[model samples]
Target: MTTPDSAAADVAAKQRIIKHMNADHHDSIRRYVEAYASKSMFHSRSAQMVDIDLNQMVFSCGGQQAVIAFDPPMKAMREARERLVQLDKDALQTLGRSDIPITKFVPAYTHPAHLWNFTQCVLAMVLLPRQANWQPGSLLYDNMLYLVPGFASFVARIGWIVFVYQPQFQINVMGKPKLALQVPVEYTIVVFADGASDSLLHGSLSFSNVPTQCDFQIALARVGRLEKGKKMKPDSASRTLMGELGLIGSQKEQKREQFDYETAEKLCVCSVGPPQESSGSKTAKCEFSLHIPSYLPATAMLPSVNISYAIFATCILPDRKVLQTSQDLRIVRETVEPIRLEPSRTVYFPDTSFAVRANFDPPTFSSKNTTISTTLQLYGLSLPITNSMRFTETRWLVPREIRWVLEETAVIVTGCPDTTGHLPMSSAQRILKRRKLATGREKLKLRYPFTRRGNTPVSMHSDGSGFSVPLTVSGPKDLSLDASTALSVAGGHILHAILDESNSDLNELQWRFAVYLECGLHIWLRIGEDVFDEASGNLVNRKMDEMAYTIVCPLTTSRTVTGQHDRGDQDEPVPMIPPSYDQVWEQPPPEYATPEGFTAAEAHTTNSLVPQDLLG
Candidate 1:
């Protein structure tokens, strides 16, 4: 219905408008993505479910967001804009606006609708703090580059019109077309805390992407020393001390050899004497080193040294009126390297040369009342100057087992109180006591044990040092009773407890009482029901009897990172709703706002001046 001249003008107008819209899309996208980069954000790692053509560019789009992971030419935004620009041309001609360019009209109304969808997809990919993405200019774009594809160069030449007058639109551009996002997902990484599982393990390449071999040499041993003195003749028939030493603990005792003669000669010459009268007393020293293996396969099972250590406990409660208990414990050193240990996870330690015998007796509980018996043991031991070994073993390989020969020797037990003429307690005992009456606070008095080595003394205090019973419940609510057995050594302690009448209690009445010692380390025990019977102890084995409870108590009151690292970062904030379809349709589209020094009509009139007028 329009004239040929009008139709031609309308086509030109439509083309102009489409060009402007594309220009706006590009410029805005740059601003958006850059805002995300400035904040250094990260998006969730979840993959999206895309239904686009496999042959065409496709991207994931689900969960809180979706993103097109590709370079500039491959950007989904570019492809979408191309399709939308074509639609803009068709719409403008249909409107019969022959004189106005599609570029000018599209900016005034059509473009924002298409942009809203694109902006929505991109915003979802941004990793920012909750509620941070809404600010304007947080992101920017530059659509002028659309001309680089040659045939489309005319499109960009038109966009340059705005840049010529509006310099504010041209500043602070980013290099590399990266989809920088300010998503909050980076916070989740902290959940893997210190001594936690799957920590960052450093991996390096040795030119050829093959695994490098790591060799380990483990050696563990006990050394022995001897002192020589003239033998005090034995009343019964037995080999002389000199004869036994010549062969080194063998059945066929060899005669004293050249070394023995040399030792004897030296002793004889150094014999003590008084005023020329011979006293005939001298001494010679002998020492030897022995190697023993104490480590098993436990250490190799660990993923790395940065992991925290873990302990596995099993408590045995007597069910048959007759009280009995069997306890087997193994102690190994950890932290020469950091290692990860899951709380309550069972892991074995390797390269440990420490061993101890499980010494326990079945506690005799009075039948009249539910009686409790607790046994505490310290698993690290060093030989007295002359203490003998009854058995020994080297179990460092698969199905490791102990191998040994028990040897007895004569050496004085030093550092033991001469008054008692007995060895001191091997280590420290932080709380060694029992109670019967009930109170609001589990007010059991604590006793500490200590040991002496040479002149220096070693007391068993919690690593950070001191007791940490915060609020003691006189008795666990619902459960009739509770008890604990703990020892502190090498800055750590084994804490064990038993509960009674646990089933009838509500799990919600739980409370956490923590002990903070002077050393700044805090040990917390959760007094609650054992939802999982995995807790090893006496109460768990007897289900029908008076129900029982188990609480985690620290042997040495110290703070652990495990207690501090809870699931705080897992929560994510809901993002703002994208500009809606109805809103985008109803909203005013972008227009060239007049710059400070120029009026629109004045600007058009100014361009009307001839080139020659500028020369005057």
Candidate 2:
């Protein structure tokens, strides 16, 4: 007598031996022969092969073994039918809670023998059944099926499954026809096709230790509810009987014909009235309008935004074709933010550029050539500051005025806002990261500072750093200049230059123009080219400077422009040379009076690619 424990031990021993034999590298041919001989004997239905050598080896020695499934054809059918009925019950219970009600479970019989033969190529024991239900006034139907997990491992039916019926199998001793089944009698296991025809349903569920005989009541909510049902077909809608059993089908058929016989919707017919003819030539005029919101801050003053625009126009026609034209147009708008006047100064609009774009459809386009033209205008302010009414000075108003064109390009910007107090030195370092002023050699020739006449001496002083003086304009006027001025510094100081001035105080005033110009350049460079770096918030208050310069330049432009004209009208002012602002600018604001807390501009790291003279 084989006890469950003995049977399990035998199976485990066979499995161990099979695994060992399979792992042995006795060559593929030898392995195949041994496998075939051993597997065939175990699978043979004849009892004669029960004691065969291969079978004995598997039973006693081989570590691995295969299982022989025994599911009689008649028994398979009966279980499948039972599963189908169970599915009908489950689905009815599930769908019935909704507006839909079960009408019947219709039996559908197909040639199981034919299906089984075809399933030989695959595996799956399946039974399909139709389910009928009623909706409001209509009868709805769906098809569902049950499948023995492993029997239909390869067999699949398309589009027929609406639910699955899983039934347990056990040997019946007192039954009329005793038969062996492939399923365990413990669990209800089911598998849906999931769009495949050759899928197996076996071993999907092992019996769980849940109480099977608990007298717990199962309300309608016990089963999962079906998704909302689709609208009933017009052919299925029904009507009430009048002295006769009027069928839903008849009513649906009548309604369907009524729907089919309906006339086509009457064409919308109100007349638009004949198109009014025009006497003049059909020369349609297209005027493009651009409306920029006032929110855009000015660029000249602090916290200002200066915008320049360029427009590229394109016309798309009825036939998926385009006619395009592009033009660069500069737009200058003053800052809408209010300004508080401190000294005397106004914003200046240097000749700059902006961007714009336009679109036109067929009606706006013409086969005849059309032209687009663009022009740029800059506008700003001018404010005057009252001096101590000092002694008068004399200078030249020459056509070639001794002007200092300190051309600086903003290399980068770290968009940090100013804090309530002093910014840490680290803030400046981040803004200046990776961006070094172009060396004089790498910068274009026309962009650098060189006197039109003889070479002029150039001196630069940043923060409290000593003047790099008398770097005599010793080279040729056209000669490219390269300066190695990365003198290490202690803190964040701004870039400033001193001209050949007699009095240092007067000299400081002369450099204001250059400082503002550098500020403008920096703003554009940082806003357009650099990433927003926050760590650089403490150094020199970088972000607020940008904002303040932008606002002040544009907001006070009217005063500045006026002052420039007024100064121009007066007798030629002295050709004031640049002055160093190392002390004043580098000085910590009154709020931050610590003498050592000077914010020195970052040392212009040498970029061999950029010319040093570019910022001269």
Candidate 3:
């Protein structure tokens, strides 16, 4: 298995190997290409190192390609170097060219010492469009190169030694025969490797007419700032006075200085054709491949710092005028991974006489419809009852409505702080504050009403025995489920149950239930009662009991196979079992609190004055 640290180390090792080869081993790479890759009958004019790996090196020259493999997979850069040296010696002996001198294959251009010391090598290169003012008859061709750091430079040059024109007459708009214009242009593209490092830079030039000689140079410059502590040069009298007063060591104002260095490098160039088309202007295209350096930071846009790279091209016209254009390049890093999670088990409410269990068919679901199963069993003290002179009756305990809710919370950074003393607020906070103000209206309405609201009531037999009810609830089909994120402001869901309130006028009670199922499942139940307050002439909601449960939801995964050889077998869905409770009561006695603000007589009067509006 590859740990994060090991993966990082692998990336760093590859980067070091690439930089060393591209910066200092250009000649060695060319030799390897000739010895291991080139054939005697098919000699290459120019070879550029394109890519390298543990197993092999790939090179390209013009349209031809070749690969040279290591005898044993290279574990590091040291082994790679030793293997290259051996291959070079073997290649020379095999070709019977052991006497060839290294100097005979010197590159056409080389960087001067001064140009090699200015700046770190360019990280990326891009080509921009040519100037629009060039002669219409002369055609200019542009090709973009994606350069990876630590790759050898690619060079190409083309010129015409002489021009022979054969003039042809053409009819003009005015019906007069006119001679067509003919122009000759020469262009060169040179991608140079940084002498200090394996970074690459591009240089290109085009001229209206063939010149005596063509030259291309790249000037790299770096500007830096320096801050120096203030230096004190006290006069003789002041120094003596300050020494006597013990003030000679006092601080002085600081000084600042700015300095810059610039260097220019002459790129290698090659001469290419004597006019493929002799009578008209022509366009030539060239392309180079660049691999982005693994160690380079991605392009960033920030207020405090800006780091960017650009490629500049200058065309020296036959008249000694220079035409230049620049293009910006971007560096980025991207990674991707696929993840899978195990399913969960069914969970039950905790520490209560009331029995309840909730579970989903498949604990984990993608964007698909899933069913939730719930079971309830009530006995002695948990069952509700209605009393009358003719008969006393007990009823089943079940929720009137249920809802699956999705909520989100986020950590947001405000763009800027307020100039005044007020604290900054995020957009989500502002919206929440507004909603809080309307809580009275929103909370009073029924949020999720039962689909079959007016259905006939099912009676429970009272033979001194407990009963159980099993129900299946399907989640809404419109919800979008995401398993890729943690449960936070942008990623969480909950289930809520609104149990039916006791309708008996004598008992003014309500219960609210909620379940949380993320890392684990937990249940919260709040028991509250409505009481009329005669002293205040209003109704009050008093909380009586709070219960909590830690439960589990069984996890499952969907199985769908798609292949000619698949057996197509699938697992059957698990059936939900009802929870079993040991006891039930018509009206469970409330846990008592001291009646501090009202007397017992007043409480009786308040209960008697309960309005019809408060009954439901």
Candidate 4:
């Protein structure tokens, strides 16, 4: 039924598809065979599409033939590609998987969407207080808004937080930096009191910490000077107070480690909204970014240090009273997951005495990637050539197992507290998975040992012939109630936020991968090394498969470079919508010309439910 010309074209098309799939979409072929043929091959790794026809597609999954029939046969080769994508989608859904492809990625957008409604509300409250119709009203008739009757009275009584003609401000982080951020100050206050002098919105960021202690070293010293005409006995168990003199020896003097209660440093001073009334602009937008760089000895609260950031703002009211507020700034640090993968991605996972270099299936990897192809290889486990094992001619390992894990390592770094003798430290960890490379012991041949000594760093090399080992790490899975897993720069990982639930760390501490305090793929080998037995206090040859070699595999990520995103439209003015009748009462009509009710005539004062001021 088929013509010669058509058959030739079809053959060429089939070859192209096979080559492409085998080269790039090996996982897809494996999935197709599993979805269309059998779920039994789900765990089996190897998959290759060997043949295809109009009626059926054949593949080898895990060394077994899997034939999948095309119920509606494709009329042409071009249709094959489209149909395959659809099949993959269906297969992914059916198998509870995601379309998150197996590929390397780069950065993407960061900030959240703007709250236009809230923005308009704050702008109205500040720029047009008296004309604006909300919670606060004119200073004169503000108390009487409840007497007459209506919706305005309801809000006035309940929303007592905002005061009439009062100014309020809050500091928020606009963007994060390596060790700094754009501390954008937002103002939600009424206009400066009429004829108020020296009306400047001034503030400063202050740093405070516990007492600074000097670094000391332990050394042997006689305390004969402290003990006059008496011999002091040394307590072998005493870690301190050795023979009546403190055993601590002062080393090279370092900078003061912390601050005292009496001593506080103002890290940076900030003037919100252009020095008070510079341009007479009601909407006091913060044009300057408060950059808190990590240069000072007491700056940015570097990890393990106990410095705290507090924002202090001072304002003068009409009566010349200075009103000030100070709130703690939650400084969050993000861990750097920087990885470099150029034309080649043969990355080395180093350990003390062991090392492994792996070339991934996609030749690149990040937290966004799902799985690794069976092309992994390990090299050497070099140890220091110490005196004990100097004559060791050969090296051997029982080869316990290889484990891939998704682990979260958290630390609650307590700051230098005011009181001493308190060990300020806390930590917690959660493991999502611990996938093993084998179900039983691995049998391998003994080979020549690798050794290094004296200043030459170990674990930068590999000894054994590394081969591709099966790795089964996949995540960001979808389930109804399952908690979220980690992602990379490309995968929209929040990276930093206030913890939703209370944690043992700090009350509001949250971080990821800043310092060694990061979570990601952790791989380790359960192999034995020669160590002296503690019980016998002698060298023992006994081997045990305890966790020895570990490599916290850093995630390689790629990000898309994008211009300034989420820039609100400056051209369009926010439309002020009048309140409905449901929010108004018969006694006093609702006002719209202002957010603050600073009306000159008492008649327009609408906050009063009763006409108390008008009748007076």
lDDT of 1 by residue, 243-296 (tens): 455623333222222111111101000111112221112121111121212211
Lowest summed lDDT window (length 10), candidate 3:
433-442
| Model 3: how far residue 508 lies from native, Å | 69
* Root-mean-square deviation (CA) per prediction: 43.9, 34.2, 26.1, 39.5
TM-scores of all models? Answer: 0.12, 0.16, 0.24, 0.23
Candidate 1, position 250, lDDT: 36
For candidate 3, write residues 409-454 as lDDT tens digits. 1111212122321223331121110000000001111111111234
- Overall local distance difference test of candidate 3: 0.31
Whole-model lDDT values for every prediction: 0.22, 0.22, 0.31, 0.37
Candidate 3 positional error at 87, Å: 2.2
Q: Which ten residues in a row have the lowest lDDT in candidate 1?
A: 262-271
Instruction: Please identify model 3 stretches exceeding 4 Å from their true place.
Output: 1-18, 24-83, 89-351, 359-368, 371-550, 557-616
Candidate 2 C-alpha error for residue 436, in Å? 15
